[model samples]
Target: MSHPRNTLRTSTFSCTWCRVSVPVATADGGQRNHCPACLHSRHVLDQVTGGPSTCLGAMSPIAIAVPRAGDWTVVHRCVRCDELACDAVREDDNQLVVMRMAVRPLAQPPFPLEAFGTL
Candidate 1:
């Protein structure tokens, strides 16, 4: 019941923004602990949320993918680990926010719109 990272209190949990639960590290097996939706996580790991990050900065949504069960997952880049984790987005997640995050890349030109206009 105790993980080495007990000092590291990020016992993965569901994201309020997303309704899905992510699997947390458990003795029996991995439990869905993180929310699969919006993939936006609070700063609870630092012994404080909405405060300075011992890890430095809020978690960012870096990648998106479709995993088994025909479900979608969002990958979060941990500032501390520089590690990427694919978390399932819950169905109840803010659809607009999720869609905006999903479609955000397309709106931005890879090379920058200013660069294209100079041509």
Candidate 2:
């Protein structure tokens, strides 16, 4: 005997910052947890326990991380709890925002740029 296929259900969520209706999956059918337009996410899962999180804070996209493996990830910080989270960057994600995050460290260095002249 064969099992019946599960019924299809709509999967979408509203962006916490931009208020845009977003699909839970990307154009290529990969899972997407953050808004593509704004790159904002919600703290719904616990990073430490890998379970549900009660914080439910709005996650702000702070920076971009490109690992040696060549995939890019977005760094998020919880506004309410200050918890940090990382999510894979999808192709549908806003490129402008991604570039801004990637270049932020170079544009606004923690230390004075003048110090680099001595090197």
Candidate 3:
């Protein structure tokens, strides 16, 4: 018996920051774009062109954004190219890390907090 030449193979990518092997898909069958543990991603896809990117920079999670639709997305910044990207939050993602990013703005506000007390 001869086997078919056309076969799909399992694919995985290593996290640029955490160095963890992440599956291409999540447990709920959703596509994974970043690591669940460290939440870091590789700049391998161009958001504007929707094609493979040549930057290959390490993307760092900067903030968490919640839109009116009630969906949360993690905002990342490319260390090399300074590009910005967003990825959906997975169920298996670390809650502590996500919370930290969410409260970062309040924790370290751009303006001094004493200004509010004067009023």
TM-score to native of every candidate shown: 0.46, 0.84, 0.81
* Candidate 2 lDDT (Cα, 0 to 1): 0.87
The per-residue C-alpha lDDT of model 3 at residue 71 equals 76
RMSD of 1: 9.9
The deviation in Å at residue 88 for candidate 2 is: 0.9
Clashing pairs in 3: none
How many backbone collisions does model 3 have? Answer: 0
Clashing pairs in 2: none
Tens-digit lDDT track for model 1 on 27-105?
4544443444555654344342434455533456776677667777776776654644466666555577677777777
What is candidate 2's TM-score against the reference?
Answer: 0.84
lDDT of each: 0.58, 0.87, 0.86
Error of 3 at 107 (Å): 1.3
Candidate number with the higher TM-score (1 or 2) = 2
The positional error of residue 57 in candidate 2, measured at the CA in angstroms, is 1.1
* lDDT per residue (tens digit) for residues 18-111 in model 3: 8888777678878888988899988989888999999999999999999789678999999999999988888999999998888889987888
Which number leads on lDDT? 2
RMSD per model, one decimal? 9.9, 4.6, 4.5
